[model samples]
Target: MDTVADRVKHLRKQLKLTQTTLGQCAGGISKQAVSQWERGITEPQWEALNALQRACGVNPYWLLHGTAPMLESEHTPSADATPVGPSPPGHPGTCPLAELLDDLSRRLAAADPAVRDEVTRLVLRYLENPPAGARIAKAIELLLGEDENLPPA
Candidate 1:
């Protein structure tokens, strides 16, 4: 009997998110709340589910029923759907944020579990209360650092 709890767990793993991180993405929910849901002790309320959908792009119906596909179909958008706007005037390299995120994601995917957990903690802390100016730059540098002992690529 596959339940919502099972689906939640599966989706979290598929996205490589820790329970706490998943909670944070889902409108500042608590790790315990995610734990309980995964344990089938309780379920997410409607608002939380909506937040989860926005955070992870999961299909809400799929999350609930385990029936439809986990993601919305690409071809299903209405003809009147808003077209993508142009990039900012000074924006460089076309979608810099997306490129950086993709790089970080690939690095994280290749990281060992313990290192991944530590990196995840650092990221969550930064997200929770991001620093200003140069601090943000430094934080990103540190987050992307490799262990000093590793040989140069």
Candidate 2:
């Protein structure tokens, strides 16, 4: 997972935004301060983080941890269903996140650009749903905990 600093840097590059421009989007946050945040010399305050999220049109959580794809075009999953509670009882799935990611990878690996978009929409739909109940929830939580390098929320 990319840290917040890494994500911020990536976002700036992709958007062709200078520190000055990013600070402007962040509501008067100074260019020097933005540079510091990007360089990992300092962290942004919660308000500043939110401002950056709004400016970049990204989920604050995802921006911090790089858990999800950077663009809507990169998501994948099934249509008409977010991630439900879990796979059926006999289904050997461990983590829904893992399964979803694997499925997306397989589909994307096989798909042409023309048909890949619908897959992206499906992933976005499932990204919003948290796991249900302790059985799956605990496993997912512990799995996430293993990601200690993920940027702090």
> All predictions: root-mean-square deviation over Cα?
12.2, 16.1
Candidate 2 per-residue lDDT, tens place, 49-94, comes to 4466555654444665566667434555446433433443456534
lDDT of 1 by residue, 1-153 (tens): 289899989989988999999898777889999999999999775446557766677765567777556765423545563222222235532332233344455676767787667665654443333333235435544665763433454
Residue ranges of candidate 1 with Cα displaced over 4 Å? 73-153
Task: Give lDDT: candidate 1, residue 95.
Answer: 31
What are the models' TM-scores? 0.48, 0.45
Per-model clash counts, in order, read 0, 1
How does each model score on lDDT? 0.62, 0.56
